[model samples]
Target: MATTTEADIHITKGHEVLKLYQFNTHTARHYFCSVCGIYTHHQRRSNPQEYGFNVACLEDVDPFELGEVPLGDGVNHPADRN
Candidate 1:
């Protein structure tokens, strides 16, 4: 996932077809393409100031090229602890 600040993300197009999904406390906002149901990005619950986007969604970007990607621990979400 590639990250950007909340102020930096600008959806120039296809904003109409984006579907939002929220879970638990509903603090996080996850967006997906309404047509094909592919994940687009999400406003992070852990860090509301940032948005995490699916890097695979971008054109000509190979995940393999970005070796040893770091992973987050989702099972122990901060919201759940709170």
Candidate 2:
């Protein structure tokens, strides 16, 4: 059977808000939140340097406020690509 580890956790936070951005495919941009001491999802750091997706199970996020957004691919680091 497969195993679940701490890395598999969807929701993660630090002392500050993380500006998660995308670098390429599998990597995400991680930053710290300065205002509320949380980690907001952005993109990936090793991916394409863009805010593509967010954690499906985050907190205090207003669905009506955000609306329905599309999803992109983020499975591989840029350097690892051909």
Candidate 3:
């Protein structure tokens, strides 16, 4: 996942490339590339200030090289408890 501030993400190429999908609580939004059908990023419900992005969409970056990716407990997410 790419850790970046909301302002850092610039859509230089595909301005209309993403399609949004909302599920469950509907607080978070999942964005997919409309052309290739690839998951690009999502607005985090837990932390609305941040965005969770797919590292594969980044230029010249390999996810395997990042090392030790931590998984979030989505099944027990605090938002779902209510």
Candidate 4:
């Protein structure tokens, strides 16, 4: 995952570079690079106010250097419950 602050994220250069996809509930959107097919980021379903991005897309940053990333239980997302 990419380390991002909500206000810091923006698609500065490649406005048309990525393709978008969403499935089932259509609550989240996944973006991928059209040329390289790299998963770039997603409009998170759990928190539409934020985005989840791929660390690989970040320039000059190594995800391993961040240490101990936490995982979330998307399968049991609270929003899905009544």
Question: How do the residues 1-82 of candidate 3 rate in per-residue lDDT, one tens digit apiece?
Answer: 7656677766666758789999988988889998999988888887766887889788899988988888777677555666
CA shift at 9, candidate 3, in angstroms? 2.2
Which pairs clash inside model 4? none
After best superposition, candidate 4 residue 1: deviation in angstroms? 1.0
Give the number of colliding residue pairs in candidate 1.
0
Error of 1 at 42 (Å): 0.4
- Write down the RMSD of candidate 2 (Cα, Å): 12.1
**Evaluated with lDDT, which candidate comes out highest?**
1
The CA-based lDDT of model 1 is what? 0.90
- What's the distance in Å from true for residue 21, model 4? 0.4
Error at 75, model 4, angstroms: 7.6
Q: Model 2: per-residue lDDT, tens digit, 1-82?
A: 1112334535444534444444444455544466654444444343333443334335686545666765436675445667
Backbone clash count, each prediction separately: 0, 31, 0, 0
For candidate 4, give the lDDT of residue 14: 66
Model 2 misplacement above 4 A: 1-27, 53-61, 64-82
Clash pairs, model 3 backbone: none
With a 3 Å backbone cut-off (N, CA, C), the pairs that clash in candidate 1 are none
| Model 3 stretches with alpha carbons more than 4 Å out | 72-82
By lDDT, the better pick of 3 and 4 is 3
